[model samples]
Structures are given as C-alpha cells and as structure tokens.
Target: MDFRLTDDQRALQAGMRTLLAARYPRERLRAAVDAPHGRSEVLGTQEGAGAPGVHGAAEPAVDRRLWAALGETGFFALRLPEEDGGAGLGLPEAVLLFEEAGRALLPGPLAATQLAAGLVPGAADGTRIVTALDGPGVTAHLASADAVLLLTGDTARLLPVEGGTGPRALAAAPFRSVDPLTPLHRVRELPSPARTAALGPAADAARLRREAALLTAAQQLGSARATLALAVSHARHRTQFGRPVGSFQAVQHLCAQMLVRTDLARAGVYAASLTEAPAEIMGAKLLADSAAIRNARDCLQVHGGLGFTWEADIHLHLKRAWVRACQWQSTEESEEFLANELLMDAAGENAPGVWWDTLGEENVQA
Candidate 1:
C-alpha cells in the first residue's frame, strides 16, 4: 500500500501542527511540568468518590481550556462516525493529529480519550476525559479521567471515575511516574464480582488494541522527529571553538543517524496505520519506540552538558519517550510478540514435518 500522505492529509497535519504550536507552547509545557502535583481543580477525588469501595489520591487536573479548544477543533472526534457528531475521518487522520500532539508534548489522556470518543458519553466533545489500561496494572490520567476503559481479553468495560455506582469498581493507588506530564494510578482491583458495562465484544476489543498500539507508535514517531529537529537546530546554532558544532563530522553523523531512524520508524508507523495487521502494528511499535528513545539520547549527546539541565527541553522529551515506551506495549514485550509471530508464520509456511528437520544442514548442526 502507498504510505505517502494525500494532499488533504498533509493539510490536516499542518493544521494540527499549527494548533498545537499555538496552544501548547514551550512555556505552557514547562508550566505543566512545574505545576503542583497533588492539587486538584476538577473531577475525581482522593477518596472513593466515584465507587464507594475504590480509593486513590487525586491527580492534577487537565488543561480544561486547551482540551476544549482541541474538542472544538474535532481532535477527539476525528474517528467517530458522522452521525454521532464526529469529523468522520479514519485512523490515518487520527494518527496525524496524535503525531502533532506528541511533537508539542501536549499532556492529558489524549489517545485514550480519542479511542473512547464514540463509546463513552461526552468523550467526543472532550467534556469527559478517559483513560484506558489492559488488565489494570498502572494507568495514566485516572484522577482526571471521567471514565476508564478496561480492556480484558475479548472484552472491554467502561468504569466511570467520577460518579460510578456500579457493582464493580477499580481500586487505585498513587504511583510515581518518570514522566511528570503523565500522572499514574495503580489499579489494585478491577472488574470485580460484577462486571462494568461492556462496550464491545472480542473483535472490537482486538481492533481497539491495534489502533491503540498504532496511535502510540505515531506519538513515538512524533517525539523522535521533534528531537531530531532540536538536535539539528542546536548543532547548527551552538558554537564550539568558534565553529558551529554541526560542521563537525561527529555531530553530522549523529544527526544523520537520528534522521535515518526517525524516517524508518515513520515508514513503519504509516504503513501499519494503513494495514492494521497484528504483526505490522507490533513491528511499528518496536521501531518507533527504539527511534524515540535513541533519538532523544542522541539529541542529548549532541547538546552535551547543557542537555542534562532541567531547564532544557531535551530531558522532558527523553522522559516522555521512556514513559511512552512502556505504554500500550513495552520494548521487550513487542519484541517477544513479534518473534512469536515470526515463528508462527514460519511454522505455518513449512510443509508437514518436524520443524527442526526443515532447516539446512548448517542450521541443524547449530
């Protein structure tokens, strides 16, 4: 399939970039990072306010104004059906928007909320924030999330965080996260004796997981691209020994390597967005994760000692990349999954025989 973006897609991507650059400037991102952690100015509480038996500390509220602006721009509603009041776009468009969000370091439960748009009430409009988790270990943005989408094997459940009275509840506890922009809550109990509302069956849940992984890969792609630009910019402007650092062979090589990795990951992500196959999505996640993490580290190296300071934005991108690497799918996990898939495909392709016997004499000897 063609991986190139259409003209309309390019326009959409440019529009998203413009919106994020205007709304989520570097200063705003710094403010969010430096904001008080425990202060709550919105929904959900430290206590078991939603479900009587569930409890957890309150997290910092999301930027309501910025969220509203995104909603008005149809960010969250991009993939929802037109009849349901959405932009009536597909996953490709959603991926483009998410890429811009990642580049801007726009905080909040963006992917979860976008995935929840049509499934959960108010999610399409951004009036309600939603976060999701698979099998409930640690979830992001739970305190501010109006609802939590719980993905179990072959099924999904919606747990309201603010005003849930269902028989089932999610017991949460405060957990420290490497990324300050992403608040986390550990879900100790989930989908108890009585299950929450079932939003979709096995097939839909599978689709959700695929989309989630692809979208997350897109975010990693964005971060990788952004850090590459930063590294290139710094190398060009920063002077060392009366000469621009970018002119040095070592710095040029680092920038080139970063660019290569970013482009390779971008290709994987774009192709997966179109294919939506399990292997493709997993491969994309792996490539994107590596690109984001390594590019940030390389960018830091290019920046030298100045990159380690809290004042610089390099560390923030690094931290967010680390956090995202664990989200949806971790590096090790994706590797294992991809490996298993390859093995499965090989097994399927080989004629009926002992798998080991099908190999060449060199392989057999090994």
Candidate 2:
C-alpha cells in the first residue's frame, strides 16, 4: 500500500501554498486583523448597525478579490463532480487545500464555503459565501456569508440570505470574537429557515459532518506544521549568549517535540482522509487539535519574549488554533466518542487481542 502522494496531489498542495503565499502574506493578514471590519471602517456605527441583512455595516470579514481568486482556482468546487462543473477531486485533495489554508491562516468561512459548493448556487463559483452552524449558538463569519447551512440531526437545510431572511431573520447578534479574523454572530433562536435546498437524507448529512471534521483536522495539521517551521526558523537565526538559540539543548528538545506531534497528527489526518470512518475522523481531529495548540505554544516558547508581542504571528496562530479547537468536535466530546468505540470493539466477538493477532498473521504472510 503506497502512502506517498501522487503527482497530481503534490501539485495541488504546491499550487495552494503558492497562491496563499502570494495573496495572503503575513502583512496582508496583519492588515486585515487591524482593519475595523475587514477593509471597511465603522466611523460611529453601533454594533449591529449594518450587519449582513440589516444594511448597516455589511463589510465582509474576507477579501472579495481573494475569495474570487480561490474560486477561480476551483477551491470551493474541488469536490464537486466534473459534470457539475467542478474540479472533480476527492476529500484527500480537499484536505490538502485546507492544510495550506491553515498554514497561511487564511480568513473567512472556508470549510463551510467548500462544503456548500454543489448544494448552494453560486457557491461553486465562489460568488456566494456560505457559513454553517456546526452544532448551535454562534456561527462564524455570519456577517459576510450569503447563505447559512443548518445541519439539524439527519436533515441539512440551506438557507439563502436576502433582505434580512434566512440566518439574518433568526436574530443574529454580533459576538466579540477571540480571533480577529473569525467574526462570530450569536443566533438567539433558529427560526424555520426559508429552505432553498434540502440536501439529501440522513446519510448525506452524516457524511457532511464527517467531512467537515476531517477537513478541519487537516487544517489543524497545517497550523502545527507551520508553527513548527516558524519555531525552527526563529531558533536558527536568533542569537543568545553568542550562539544560536537552536544550538541549545532545551530549544532542540522543544522543536523535536513539535515535529513529533505534527508528524503524528499528519499521519492521522491522511489516514482518516482515506478511510472516512467516523471514529477515525474523530481520532484524527483529536490528535490534530492537540498538536496545533501545543505546537503553537512551543513555537511561542522558542521565540522567547518576542512571541508575546502583538506584532508576532505566533499569537495569531495560537488564537486561531484555540478557536478551531472549539469547532467540529471539542476535546472532551472526541475523547468520549473514542472511548465508546474502544469499549464496543473490545466487547465484540473479535476481541482486541484477536484482531491484533489476525493483523500480525496477515503481515507475516505478506
């Protein structure tokens, strides 16, 4: 079984990296963070003065040009079938793209928009921005979205935004966000949405949730890898006591630990992408969330006091990781789900030991 990336996959990853580097440079990211509402300024406007539907401050949190560029690259449409005018890629490809997005800390409702491609009109072309309500309560980037996807149990509803309708009609109030790039809106109550599309049945909704978890895990993996790179670069150049900080044993150990966590999480993300199993996806997200958060902390440690400054990108990575951790599946929820799977497996006719022995026998024959 070959685990290596194919030529096309490698190309896709490289292309996304190049695009993000050019379009969403660190400078651009910092500027976006500093801007009052993305590129727009709220002079004396109240909190919800011109939110999405109300017509006050509808300034989107994302850059329209960059969003269009992503669409031109077929980012949101990556998984749509070719017959549907998409790139006709699979989940693995989507994961690769998301990992690069994470590395760059690209802003906006990326996962939601990507998931909306085939189901929502104009989504595939990136003309329409879509955000999702993962579970309930606050939805990220609601002010910028053209539509909202509500996943309630087995049913997935697509609510279009027009003149204070859909999610806007549900009484979306602004919530102070921790990550500057992730603008959140609190949904007080879920009004019966003007359903534009009822996407498939229970099976499809389940698949969408699973896909979301997997892609988010991939993003976490990207952040872990990026932080590891940042730490390594900073340690190599920063001098202390007439020697590079990287030369010190303590710094080396920190970097080594970051590398281990990142690689381990990467393996899990890639494996889950292939299997698409609910348990494996949850486990991947668990590893990725930990790796992303811890790696960013270690990265800050590697940078010493400099990392604590607002200008430093390390804090941004840490803040974004913290936010991502809350999405998809929380640590406790993932742990509980994995524990149930383990107990169920152990109780089955194929005991853990037996399963291991069977695997060993197969490996021996091979």
Candidate 3:
C-alpha cells in the first residue's frame, strides 16, 4: 500500500516542526530540565502551596503558561471534531504532532489531555484537563484539571477532581520515572463523586492500548531520529586516528544500522496509524519500542566516552527512550499480543509442513 503522506499532512507536519523548533528548541528543553520542578514545572502551580490536594514535594511541577500557550496554538485540539472546537483531523495528523513533541522532549499531560479531549464531552477545545488509565497518582492525572476523565478498566467516568484551584490529593506513588520531564504520581485515595458515572466503555480497551502504542511509537520514532542525527554529527566532527571517526568502517556500519532501525520503526508506526486493528497497532508498538531502545544504545556507543557525560545531551534522549519504551505496554506484553494474534490466525489453517521442516533443520544444525 502507498504510505506516502498527503500534501496536506506534509504541510501540517512542517508547520508543527517549525513551531516547535522556534518555541521549544533544545536550549529551551535544557532550561526546562534545569528548572526546579523538572518536567512538571510546565503545569504551573495550584492554590494552597503546601496543602494536601496539590502535588507533593516529589512531583515535577509543570509550567502553566507553556501549557496554556500550547492550548492556544491548537496543540491540544488537533484530533477532535471541528464542531467541538478541534482541528477536525484524525490519528495521522495526531501522530505528526506527537513526533515533534518527542523530538522536543516535551513534558506535560499530552497523552492524557489528547485522549480525554476525544473521549470527554466538551473537552475538545483545549480546556485544561487530564486523564489517567490507572487513576490518580499515575503518570497522567488531572490534579488541577478542570475535569478528569477516568478509565477504570471496562468503565469510563468524567469526574471533577477539584474546584477552581485548591490542593487535592488525587493519587500517590512511590517511585518516580527516569524521564523527569513527564512525572508520574500516585493516588492515595478516591474522593467524593463531584460528577461521576459509568460511561459504557465507549472504546475498546484494546483500541485504547493501540492508540497509546501508536502515539508512543511516533514519539520513539522522533527520539530515534534525533539520536541518530546527533551520533552522525558527532562522528563527522570528532577526530580519531588522524581522521574523523565517521571515516572508520565500523562507525559507518553502526550509523547505517541506526538509520535502518529508525526507518523500520517509522514505517511500522505509519502502518499502525493507518489502521484500527489492535494487532497491527501492537506490532507497530513492538517495532517502535525495539527501534528506540536499540538506536539509543547504538548512538551512545558511537559517541564513545563523551556520550556518557552529563554535559552531552545524548543521555537525556537515552534515558527518556528507555523509560518510555517500558510504559503503556512493556516489550513482553506486545510480544504476547503478537503471539496470540499469530496463534489465532493459524488455528483454522493447515499446518505448513515445509516451514516446520525448515525450522527443524535449522535446529539440527545448531
């Protein structure tokens, strides 16, 4: 199938890339990391600084102004219906925006907000909102959200976590994630039902998982691309053995492998985004996750000792890739899903004797 993006899609991607480059450049990312709350600083602050409902000492504070700016720019309303104050786009456009977000190493309630915007009524117009898969205290929560969308297993609910601005204990968690830019929280307890009801699981859990997988794959693709670029640039500049390190055959091979993996991941993500099937999405997630982790390692190896230093930005991508690769769904989880799909597909088909024979022969050689 032809996977080329349409001209309109290309224009959208170009616009997003340009905007992110100008507003959320690398230096800005570094500054965000250095800020007091790390990635969470972008969320701004709630009233009653030390009160219970507010995020605790450990939570990474988010920058409120930046989030509002993002909303104003239509970043949060890209995939909703036009009637609901959205750009009237779909997953493909959303994927492109996410890719730019990944390259920028942006930190905020991006996924939750996007998902919530689509699922929750009236949330499409970039209202400050947050949703959580595991409920409060997780990676994405609406601590200060104007509204909170909760996906509790087979049920969905829209609840008001707080009023206007006040400290409220949504959830709590023990350990923090490596990507401090996207902080995870733990919900200590569930509050009263300010507005709560079970919405028939409007979307399949599998579909939601696929959405997470695809969006994450887009992010990983960007990370892998950025990392590969950094490694190649470093190789071309760093001198070794009286020539640039990139002149070495071994370094060239490493960079080549990195490029191949990045391309493969990108293709997989694009394929997954085009479909609604869960298995296809799982495959995409598996490919993207593998590519991101492997490419990051390969990139780090190419940089040699310098890549390990704190000053080098390679580790930031490495750490973020590692952390994100394990989230939404682990590698093992995706593999199991793929295995199940394969088994189901083979259930009614005649066994291929030749395939088994080939496998048996390979085993015998071993």
Candidate 4:
C-alpha cells in the first residue's frame, strides 16, 4: 500500500484534529481529571449511568453526547462493514483516526471500543462501550465497558459487563491512572457465574491482537509527533542568556534526534499496518514505544523546570506516553519477541526442526 494520505484521508485528519483541539481543550481535560470518577463534567457524564441505554445511564465517566458525536464521526464503526451498518473502512483509515485521538489525548479504551463495534451490540452506535482485553485474569476500563473481550491463550470470549439489574460487577475497584484524565479500573475480582455472549478460536484472537497493537502504535506515533512539535515550539520561543533557547546547538541536536525517532517510528507503524508479518508488527511496536517515551522525556528536558510543574500540559502527554508504553506490549516484551525471531533465523537448521521449518518458510516469503 502507498501509505500516502488520500484527499479524503487528509480532510478527515484535519477535521478530526480541529474538532478535538476545540472540544477537548487542556482546561477541559484538567477539569475531567479533577472531577469525580463517574461525574466528569468534561465528558457530560450521566447522573448514574448504570445501564445499556444512554438516555438515563448514570455515573458514566464519558459524555453521552460526546460518544454520540464520536459515532457520528464514524469513530467506532470505522472498520466495520458498511453492509452491517458500518462505515466499512480499513485498517489504514482507522489508524489515522486513532493518531488524531492520541494527539488530542482523548481518554478511554479507544482501540477496544473500535474493535467492539463489530462484536458488541450498540457499540458501533456508541451506545455501548467495549474494552478489548489482552488477558483473561485482568483488564482495564472494566467499570466503564459495556462488554469485554477477554483473550486467553488464543481464545476470545465476549463477556458482558452489564446485567439485568445493572452493570455487572466485572472488577474489584477502580485505580487512579498516572494520567489522571485516563482513569482505569481493572478486573481484579470477578462476579461469580460469569457469562459470555460469544466465543471465537485462536485466529480471531490473533487478529484482535494485531489490530490492538497496530492502533496503539498509531496513537503512540501521534503522541511522539505532538511532543516533537512541542519541543520545537518551546525551543524557538523560550530564551536563555541572550539568544532564543532553540538557537543553542544542544537544543538543535535534541530536536533533530526527536524528529528522527518520530519519523522512523511512523514509518515502522505505517508499514506494519500494511503488512501483517508478526516480526514487523513487533518491530513497529518497539519503535513506537521508544519514540513516544523518549520524545516525551526529551521534550520535557527542553522545557526545563516548567516540564516538572503540575500546571504544565506537557506532562500530560508524557504521563500518557509512559502509561501506554507499559500496556499492550512493554519494551522488554517487544525486544524479546524480536530477539527470539532473530535467534530463530540465526539458528537456521543447526538444531530444532520446528524452528528450522518456521525460519525456512519465513525466508521463502521474504
């Protein structure tokens, strides 16, 4: 695939970016963080959202209107088939939207919800919030999710988070995320006699994982780019001694390195989206995590003491980046996955037959 944005895609990107910048301002985000868990004013939460319908759903952290607005924007239904009342887009378009969401620091289980559009009832319309889970034992956004897809050893189970009386008790309690705006609740303790709406085999689970990693990487890419721009902006304006801070050679070098990392990561993410190779996808995840985390830190360094201040908005990006870096696949896991792939190739036919066959097939494909 070309990876170049088409006319429609560019317009979509610009529109989404403009909307998020206007609607989800820094002040609004801060207010959301300060507000109570289920009553975030920024998101226009319901009084006691505890059911499927959004009309009277109370205690919702996300704004009902905002969720509807997202549905209108085709956020949740982006990749679902049009025949199935979806936008029927593809992975590329979906990733673009995700990138903008990350740039705006939009909170919630975004990737999971998107995937849920096809599975969870009312998800495509944004009436239901779906959390795509990586593990069965524990997951995030449990309290907010209408449904949860638990992946355990290549099998996927679509578990309902709601019950006839009210929302099901899927988790033990909510945890305050490092990124205050992004509140998290894990499924530490499960309500007994759990029920699943559907189930799928290993292939389905694998596909879900791919989508999760790819979309997450896109989000990280957006954050990296945003931080790069921030550092550049600060360097250009903030002054030290007599000249602008950006005029300093050290600042220039830092900015250059940030740009390089961000661009390389973008390339990797875009490529991974096009090609479904496991190694390539893992490589993309590695690059993206490095770019987001490293760039956020470097941007902070450029900002000096101001970066450390609570009032500064830059730290929000850094915190979110830090949180995301650990989720999905950590730096260590990505390295190990890639390292093992390399080792398999290096081993060739020297020892294990299984490893040799896998390496041999991969070589043939390449």
Q: Model 1, 7-85: lDDT tens per residue?
A: 9999999999998889888988887776554223332335422222112333455777888889888999998779889
Worst 10 residues of 2 by lDDT: 357-366
lDDT against true structure, model 4: 0.72
Question: Which tens-of-lDDT digit does each residue in 1-366 have in candidate 3?
Answer: 678989998998888888888777888888766655543323334342212323433344455566666777777788767887788888878888888788777766576677776676544545565655544434443344555555555555655554423234453343445665655444566555554655566644445656766888788888888888988998999998889999999999999999999888888888777775676777777887777788888888999998887677777887788877766777897887566556545554233221222233331110
Query: Candidate 4 on 1-366: residue-level lDDT in tens?
Result: 576888998988888898787777777777765555433323222212332223322233555567777887788898888898877778878878888888877877788888777677788888887776676333445556667766544556677756311124453334345665554445554443256554645327777787788888889999999999999999999988988999999999999999999999988988887786777888888898889889999998899999888776678788888788777777897887676667667765333223333345552211
**Poorest lDDT segment (10 consecutive residues) of candidate 4:** 44-53
- Residue 217 lDDT, candidate 1, scale 0-100: 87
Higher-lDDT candidate of 1 and 4:
1
Off by over 4 Å in 4: 36-60, 136-138, 153-155, 163-168, 188-194, 199-203, 349-366
Which candidate leads in lDDT?
2
Candidate 3 regions with alpha-carbon error over 4 angstroms: 36-58, 121-123, 134-138, 141-147, 163-170, 187-195, 198-206, 349-366
How close to the true structure is residue 171 of candidate 1, measured as C-alpha lDDT? 63
